[model samples]
Target: MAVVSVQQVSKIYGHRLSLVNALNNISFEIKSGEFVGIMGPSGAGKTTLLNMIATIDQPTHGRVLIKNQVVSRMREARLANFRRHELGFIFQDFNLLDSLTVRENILLPLALDKFSVAMIEQRLAQVSRVLGIGNLLARYPDEISIGQRQRVACGRAMITKPTLLLADEPTGSLDSKSATELLQYLTVINRQEKATILLVTHDAFTASYCRRILFIRDGQLFSEIIRNGNRQQFFNQIIDMQATIGGGGRYNAITPGH
Candidate 1:
């Protein structure tokens, strides 16, 4: 079954004379348990498309559906509740509260939703074990390495067992080794927990981690590459597509204008 569906969606900015189409009639489906990547050059509307799916922005035309429901049309209160429970997000920044212990931060969502103490502990244990942050739980955010903090962020996102995971430049802040470590953890999360992930990245190496990739250019679906063999071969394919689509160079996290 499809876990996410984007049907003929478009995002327009500005008035009639100055109108800009950030996305143009894009359509795709991400199947259940799929690890999908969205890649494009800057200003290609990658994040804009993701924001619509994140329920952070509405599409100017068309709609977004998750798990067969029209999320774009949901009422505010219900949408808020749904978003809190069903959608998980990971960004380049750790976004952890400085004052809270790693354990506290990971459990914040369940606490807010009033999950029973036993259940919260259960979820936390499972997530931390997978992410390998269990050893760092009692420490504050500042006490861990950048990689460890990112792992904690992953734990927090997975603790909810969200229907879909959205990630934007999640490895932007990490060094080569750190990036590889986090990616390994993510792959483990996807296979072991069957979490559906949609990640936006400009780096071919980062895109290579996905099972299938959707490439865009100038706000449209330009091409796609599915990993057919080993990771090395998949990495080469992603790099080739990046070159073909005029995308290469170092990049950081998504911005407001992206």
Candidate 2:
């Protein structure tokens, strides 16, 4: 099933002189339970596309559908509900509240919906266990390592049981080991939980973790590669493709490499 559909999407800014086409005639379909990555250079509209899918931004001349529902046309209030119920997000900055403990941070989603204390506890235990943050529940964000904080962010995003997970540079702030571990966790989550994932990343290594990838350039869809055979080979292909796109590693700077 197609969990997300973007058809001829375009986003324009300014009048004409200083106008910017953030995204231009972009189209794609993301199927359920698939791990997909969006890659591109600095001005390639990766974050723009992710924001459109997250319902935080709307396109100028196209429609974005989530589960066959037109999200862009939904009212703001309804969109908020849709976001709360259908989408999960992990940002580069972690976005966890400094004042809240890891457990409390993970419980924010359910609490917003008025979930009972018992239910919240059950969810906290389940999600933390899945993300391997079960023992850090009592610690505040300042008390844990960057990796642990990112995992807590993951737990918070997943605690809501969202149908689709949208991750933006999730491993950008971690060490190489932490980044690899977090990527592995994401792969496991996708496979074990059957969660559809749309990740915006520029790192070939990170994209290798995805089952498929969509490359963008100059505000348009450029190419795609599927990882049906070997993951290591796929990683190499991504690197070569980025080089082919003619940027001195600037492509990596636009997404995960940040």
Candidate 3:
């Protein structure tokens, strides 16, 4: 089943005098339990497309459907409620509250929804275990390593059991080791928990973790590649595609095992 459907979506900025089309009639579907990646050059509208699907921005033309419900036309009031319940986000920077402990940070979403204390604790335990951060629950964000902090962020995003998890440049700041670890954790979540994820990154190494990738350029999807064999092969394929599409000018170099 298709969990997300973006149909003929176009996003335009400004008016007639100085108009910009950030996205141009892009259409795609992400099936349930699929791990997908969106990649492109610096000005290829990757973030703009992500924002539209995240419901943070509206499309100038066409509709976005999450589980068959039209989101582009939703009212602001209802949209807030829908976003809170159905979508989860992981940012490049760990967005955990400084004053809150790891446990409290992971439980924030459920707490906002007025979930009982018992229920919140139960959900927190499960997510913390899954992300291998059970030991860091009592520590402050500053007390943990960068990798652990990102795991906490992932735990928080998954506690709500959102229909879709949207990650934007999630590994952009981490070192190679930490980035690989986080990607492994995401793979485990996708396989074991059946969480549908859509990640946006310019790095081919990061995109290699996804089962499928969509490459965009100049406000349109230029091409796509699926992982047919080992991850190293997939990574090479992504590099080649990026070269063919004239991307990856600013992307970091990556090795086979790194």
Score candidate 3 by lDDT: 0.92
For model 2, residues 157-252, the per-residue Cα lDDT tens digits are 898889899999888898888998899899989988898999998777788899998998999999998987777777767877788774335344
Candidate 3: list runs displaced more than 4 Å. Answer: 249-252
Give one digit per residue, the lDDT tens place, for model 3 in 144-257. 999999999999899999999999999998988899999999999999999999999989889999999999999998999999999998998898888888885325567557
Give the TM-score of each candidate. 0.95, 0.93, 0.97
- Cα displacement (Å) at residue 127, model 2: 1.1
Estimate the overall C-alpha local distance difference test score of candidate 1. 0.89
Number of clashing residue pairs, candidate 2 = 0
RMSD (CA, Å), each prediction = 4.4, 3.0, 1.5
Worst ten in a row by lDDT for model 1: 249-258
Candidate models: Cα lDDT each: 0.89, 0.88, 0.92
Candidate 1 C-alpha RMSD relative to the actual structure: 4.4
